[model samples]
Target: MTSKPFNKFRIMMKSLMVCTALLGTTFLAKAQTWHFGPKFDANYSTMKGEGIKNKFSPGFQIGGFAEYNITKHLAIQPELLYSWNSYKKSDDFLTYYVNSGRSAAGNNVNLGTVSVPLLLRYNINNFLSVLAGPQYSYKIYDDEDLIKEGKEAFKNSEVSANFGFQVNLSNVGFYARFNKGLNNINDIDDRYEWKSSHIQVGIAVRIK
Candidate 1:
């Protein structure tokens, strides 16, 4: 009779141990599912022209992004980024100097901007996500040599909207974003416009 009671006790203890082990495994898997990390980006920027040949100007960014999983299909991402943008003047000045009565000056301008973007991300699957959001940018520095003569300053601050898509791996993600400027970049003259629309490719790591 004592042996029968002891055997029942043993069975109960073994079941409890299995339950505890399963719970621990579930917690570990949940912890590994969420993460945050730093990012680096490289991009190209150029002006839109009609009947003008445009060249790609190189740009880059470094930043950090955080992601929270709301479900298997939805997420929220916010990022703080430092971005550099470059633009070049048209060759019309060269044509003016050769054919018309003017001197040609080549102007290649670069602007440094600090940007913060809040994006809403929708996951199509484990490997792909689409993002769109508003971005605010403050001018940190500008190349004076690139500005036209008599201009006090180029456009310095901007607010814009961005849209992009991301490709995600287990712990790493690659993304491409396009920013469309809604504010004038030049603060000196209203007639002189400084706007930006560029495509950036970046890598992200998950920390959590």
Candidate 2:
């Protein structure tokens, strides 16, 4: 079970790296105005599905981004990030687990993933911008000590949509974004579909 997902994740990561390298190299060669930076985020995440009754769980991410200015008010931003997301199961969910002949270790699920986001940013002014984009993510690690595999757990890869706003002053930037998963992540006999969603708040500092 884990082997299949791990293989899929490796393939996806390789493909994404190729794409990122091409895009970044092209922009670096031709674009005169560019900003590259490190970013850190705090995320509040949850799952929505038939059996989920828990609230949001806190997580975080750290990574880097490159912003290429296409015009005075329009820019393209691409990011490579390592993200962590988590959730707590409801009492009903735990009961269901135990009733299914599986021992309930705990109620928490933690997932670590590598994500790539391609964003189109529209600058309203020098100080503000609005961004929207698509993101691809591949799972890297998971905490299965509690919520084991085959227990309505998530899959290897996910696609999501993001929309956000950014405030920038000099070399400092602050952003908040909402991400909604576009595909089902459930793997428990396919009886119910689960989708992940989160709110990410982060700070970015330009270094180049």
Best by lDDT: 2
Error of 2 at 43 (Å): 0.9
Q: Which number leads on TM-score?
A: 2
lDDT of model 1, residue 113: 68
TM-score of 2: 0.80
Candidate 2, which segments miss by more than 4 Å at Cα? 1-33, 94-101, 145-152
Summarize candidate 1's per-residue lDDT along 139-178 as a digit string, tens digits: 6655534224534345566898999999989889999989
> Candidate 1, after superposition: displacement of residue 91 in Å?
4.0
State in Å the error of residue 76, model 1.
1.4
Q: Please, what are the lDDT tens digits per residue for candidate 2 over residues 20-132?
A: 57657855786677778678889999988755654788998777788988999999998888787887666566544454423654566778788899999999999999999
Q: What's the TM-score of each model vs. the native? A: 0.70, 0.80
TM-score of 1: 0.70
lDDT of each model, Cα atoms only? 0.67, 0.78
